[model samples]
Target: MKPQRIFITGGASGLGYSLALICAKGGWRVCIADRDIERGEAVLGSLQKIQPQTIFMPCDVTQFDDLNAAATKLQEIWGGVDVVVNNAGVAQVGSISDTPLSDWQWIMDINLMGVVRGCKVFTPLFQQQGHGHFINVASMAGLLDVPNMSAYNASKAAVVSLSETLQNELKPHNIAVTVVCPSFFRTNLGQGMRSTITGMQSKLDKLMAGSKLNAADIARQIMRALDKKKSHVLPHRQGRIAWYAKRWLPRTWYQRLIHSQKK
Candidate 1:
């Protein structure tokens, strides 16, 4: 049997890179797509050591043409992709009132529309193939709103909503969708986060540095969830707790609890 093919956006670094490594090690033919050709090639080299069938393609998730071109190339070479992880995203730290309109646009373009573009470009091919999986990386902030992360939260929430709807709509077509809501883990995601709040980026960096979970560990768990066909995955204990709380608790109570903890 031919090895299954997995395509990951933003696979040059962070969680996407970790997922690419895990999939390649599992004998999957991995295609990593990123706008950063240098970093993408570096990661491709590493993935090639684990699985020789790995390749890196230049893809900017915010551009439909870039995503479409990458998908077209994959179809030409591999017929169809077995899995597509729409994991490229940008973060911003600021309240809705404080965040600039440009910042909101930037985050939305890359985080929410990026996923939309990926799905739009790949769904047809996956439908033709009769089976495929989409893993959209959201965040715990999407489930439970946090202060100073309005833009990031909104973008991720849109992803969660999109994934849920897609899961229902694509079930009959044999395409599976999983929305991954992970808490802060050790990753380079924070490196590019723009913030209006003073010291907010440093605080986030410190918190991530102290996190018990790492990107590789989260990648392993995501692979397990994929095998199980889970519709939603919260890879951290805190995320799971927040998810249940938001679902079961009263809106006022949850708000109070969250706000009371604000420093």
Candidate 2:
């Protein structure tokens, strides 16, 4: 039996980095893709120690050609891949009025369309191989529609929606889909965040710093969910509580958090 292979975007840092190690340690070959060549190669060196066949490919999720070429090269060299992770994304926070169109485009391009491009470029290879899995990393903001996260929320919401559509459309092809929606946990995500609101980044950094779970912990839970082939994973317990609140108490949830009040 050959070793299964997993390819991850933004694989040099944050959740992507953690998940790469988990896959490698599970005896699977790993491909860590990111635009950061320096960081990507560093991670590749670490992974090579675990699985010598593991690799690093510089992939910028915002560009279709990057993912296309990377996927093509992987297929030609590795025979096929068992999993693809569309986890490259950026965070931005602002009310709709404050978030410029460019912010929306930036987030949508890297966060949502990046995942779309991954699915588009990989489906054929997966079809040729007879089986595959897609792990789309979304967010709790997408599920919760949290206030002041217009761009980030909408971008991730689009990912969640795309994953759902793919889950049904790709089922007949023997492909599985999993959407991960975890709330903030300690990671480097804040370093790249864009914000128009004063102190917004500071506030978010504090929340992330306060989280009991870190990227590795979230990665472990995501792996457990993937083991069961679950369609979605909400790894944070508080995230689950908020999700249910929005689902079962939409009116109350909105009034408490989102309902506009005169300032």
Candidate 3:
């Protein structure tokens, strides 16, 4: 099939922007939905100069009305999107003891509920079209928990479960679902992440400093997996290994690994 239309949440920056650029290069109609209108427009302008077929729509994934409006706007232009990448998310750092209930709620509202809202709004439209794909961006944290990121881990774990469930529910409708579990890739998420307390943990900095893959590289792998209609898109080798180890290891070993830095 020819490149039709792809709508991506959080497409104004980071990995989403990179993915938008990739899809545009492949002759797809790209809609970059984001909460930041200025940033979204800037990305749209840049991509237009390079691709000329990309557009921008302001959308706050946490708000059902915003996503509904964005979805309606998209329908006017493209009728229905062929692919929806629910990638907008935030990481909040805190342990269960130190993490405030408000922080947990906020993190869940954005990271987990954001994907839920997107899927809720778009799946019906996709069904009407009789063909669609949904890509939910989870994290390596979803596969294995790390200290000082209880909220983030929980949100992503929820996304992992939700995505998998949707895959089973939407299979007969021809709407494919992919859950992307990626290890640390070079993205702006580190700088943008919010923490409940200062001096909580420098895990993000440590991870970024040691990260091997770039966002564009991960985006490429994701695109390839989408083309192959794969369900689980692990964009990094380490991610795959981590998943396997978590699955096969004893609870004691997993707990040790989760507490300690060594695998």
- In candidate 2, what are the lDDT values of residues 1-263, reduced to their tens digit? 23478999999999999999988887888999999999998888888888788899999998899999998899888888889999998899888898899989998999999999999999999999899999999999889877788889988999999999999999999999999998988888888899998987878888898888899998988788777889999888988986777788857755585554213
Question: For residues 26-89, could you state the per-residue lDDT of candidate 1 as single tens digits?
Answer: 7998999999998988778888999988999999998999999988999999988999999998
- 130 Cα displacement, candidate 1 (Å): 1.1
lDDT value, residue 259 of candidate 3: 72
**Quick one: ranking by lDDT, best first?**
1, 2, 3
Give stretches of model 2 more than 4 Å off.
1-3, 257-263
**What are the runs in model 3 whose C-alpha is more than 4 Å off?**
196-202
lDDT of each: 0.90, 0.88, 0.86
Off by over 4 Å in 1: 1-3
Alpha-carbon RMSD of each model: 1.5, 2.3, 1.8
Per TM-score, what order, best first? 1, 2, 3
Cα deviation of 163 in candidate 1 (Å)? 0.2
For model 3, name the residue pairs that clash: none
For candidate 2, give the lDDT of residue 211. 88
For model 2, name the residue pairs that clash. none
For candidate 2, give the lDDT of residue 205: 83
